[model samples]
Target: MLDRKTFAEININNYIHNINFIKNKTKTEVIPVLKADAYGHGATQLAKVVENIGIKLIAVAFLGEGINIKKNGVNIETLVFNYATPKSIKENIDGYIYTIGSLEQLTELINFFGKNIKKIKFHLNINTGMNRMGIDIYNLDKIISLIKEYNINIHGAYSHFATADNLDDFIKEQYNNFISAIKYIEDSNINIPVKHICNSAASLFFPEYSLDYVRPGIATYGMQPSDIKIEKELKPVLTWKSTVARVGLLKKGESVSYGRTYFAKETIPTATIPVGYADGYFRQLSNKGYVLIQGKRCNIIGRVCMDQFVVETTQLNNVKLGEEVILIGKQKDNIISAENLASLAGTINYDITSKITKRVPRIYIEEE
Candidate 1:
């Protein structure tokens, strides 16, 4: 079936199980990171699914993303973790929540809603070491004064870690910085309501980073953050699969695909899959990857092409056209983990999960 390969199977029940498990693990509030379309698991679908389970706050990266989530008719509080642009003030001020990291932006925000209900809740992101966003602590007092003068509702104080996924010292440094800022905000009489610094990495390995709340993104999808030893159980909730398009035998010395990247030593069997990099499957996987088919390892024997890739199934017999192929996920008696694919691509689990393009269809399977 032309529609079979290149589709992602999303286990909705698995995702729900993950959220419940995370809730049990820590006392902190859960903020599921739904940005980048829930790491390409389909944002609107995920938002609706998680909403039923009662996530108080859902996060997106930009104004349009928040708008899209809101437009979906799910009534959860949406947080824009990324900065809001000046042009988007109407949208931001009207309904969307904003995070202010720069004094100039804060000034703009105050001016936009001058003399209005200035108690609009907002978050202040402090830049401890991420070198990304946030006002330095030196200007914290000045900003606090501005916030008070404008009567802005200081809802939360937050920051991002530079290396929470790594070893102890780096996370400690960021944690100290975050806690110090939290103290500064709380001690300033601002009545800040929430303080959070944990991303996926921090949520799992660094408990100290879990302040009033912590946001877990990739880890909730059942992928480990930073290869650290994890005591908690996790399972990948997504899998990619396709059907074999064709199968043929290659004679000895016969080359396969562009550049003749791989040549068979003996007569071997091969299967062609109808998915390629255009489907968000990385092209670099040519001759450098493997997939599970019929519960056995199928090796890519040549350069991956534009719309299809070939895998040699020499060890196994009777692989035929239209047989199910698993690019990611478990098959009978075997599995080719997403981590293995990420390792082959020189990236991490986050990239692998997020890179699956929108063009590919997703099927939500209710896990039993």
Candidate 2:
């Protein structure tokens, strides 16, 4: 039923499996992060799936994303991780939990909502060590003072771990800092019902810090957070695929694609797939990437173009037009993962999948 020559297949079963696996492993509430269109796997659809599975909350990076989820009729509580202006927050206040990281943002909320500020729900973001966002640990007293002054309704308090994947001492330091912030708030008679700091890596590797909730982003989408391996099984939820649009024989010394960076070493079969940098396939993968065709690995031959690229298909018995190609998935006994593409592109797995542009149709598949 797929009409597109190239598309990303979202395996719903695998996604559910990952959610269950993470929840079972951590034994805590899992707050699936659906930001960046659920890492380019299509957020609206995934949000619906998450709700159907009884997940009470999901998180996104922006207010607009949370609004989009609400507009789609997904009733789950959405937590917006990024700061929003007072005007923007007022306009889209329903069904969204905002992260209050700074005194300025908190003041804006108080000023905008006035007495009704108590109706607004939010979580306090504590800056343990990331230093990217959130209230500084030293300044927690000021934040607590303001919260007490306004009688703010803080639903939870959380922090982010910068090196959960690496499993360093810094993680413990960050956790300690988070715990201290929570204690400071509680000492001021402020009740923080839910507390969390573990991301995907920490959720799997450091269950002790799973606290009350785990905000898993990449790992929920079935991608490993880092190079370190975990014993738990997490199936990849996406498979990018395309079809060979053209096939031809390249003679020795003949080059392919832009920049002529690749010249045929000898006579070989070449295939052009309708995928390129514009489609989220990185140009850095120029000559280093490989695609699976007929269960064989076909080496990319030249500079990846904006709309198309050539691959040496000499390993196949016969290269045919419209033959299926696996861009990121299993073929026969071999598999090409997003991690593999990320390695070739000199990036991480998260970048590889999230960069897959919107042009590629996301075809959702669930086994019955």
Candidate 3:
């Protein structure tokens, strides 16, 4: 029984299924991206799950995230994707595999570690065409020179795909650039054992680029990365739910919520759910969203409040307090997915799930 009025249910089985699917598809090392708290599915918990499943490596966006995984007794290799600062490198030397994208960042690591720089290992981020935080292909010579000069240990090399999901011509361009960069490093006598550049989209849509390691972020959470659908099987791992808080009647012409945007055209029964924008339920869903109640879709009646929102419950056979209300999940024959919310909110699926605030507790379950 759930004590919290609003919470997210995480199906561990579904998560594992997604991971296994990606692994089987790629036929290579699968590095699950746990950044943004595993796309708001709870990183620490999922990291432990990954470790238990025999996966050797996981990736995060910050030093603190990687450190948190280490602190939780998860021994999997936590690779920090962001560039490391002097303080971060010194504070937790062994907790993370830092990503060195620029010559200056690499220089900082060498300066901080000094003669012991060889003891530290990092992945080189090559900027093919994203022009994001990475060592430009033109500057790879300088980066390679510095690594040789200090005898720095290079554990891996990687790049990001800006258009892998779109299947554009530029993906080939970036792939070719990454290939040339790796060859240049090897020709200079630097051995980077692990090489990867495919994200969730590329991992699914362009498996050839999976390389030695595939970093899947959104796909691991069982959400489609884009509109380009694939034949692979992926199930949603999270179900955001709430309970009917109050049942009441709104007279004709009665307004609901703060903005008074919804005025009832006819007298109708209404149910208020204990969820709102404060709980990561977007206010943009006001008057446009629907929730599953008693196996039926109930239209949101007005502007979503800070802690509660009204939904027209006339479609239900009967409405009662404390009844199950699904914000994102299957309810009987109907379902409310994050992608559904994202579409109604004028955003992508990533924004919908990742923005779910920390106020709501996550309950992990292993469904058969």
Best candidate (score: lDDT):
2
Residue-wise lDDT of candidate 3 within 65-117, one digit each (tens)? 88887888888888889976777777777746888989888777777778787
Q: Estimate every model's Cα lDDT from 0 to 1.
A: 0.81, 0.89, 0.89
Q: Residues 68-114, candidate 2: write the lDDT tens digits.
A: 88889898999999988878877777788889998887877887788
- Which residue runs of candidate 1 sit more than 4 Å off their true CA positions? 92-95, 117-119
TM-score of 3: 0.97
* Ten-residue region with minimum lDDT total, candidate 2: 224-233
Clashes of each: 1, 0, 0
Model 1 steric clash pairs: 5-242
After superposing candidate 2 on the true structure, give the runs of residues whose Cα lies further than 4 Å from its correct spot: 1-4
The stretch of ten residues in a row with the least summed lDDT in candidate 1 is 87-96
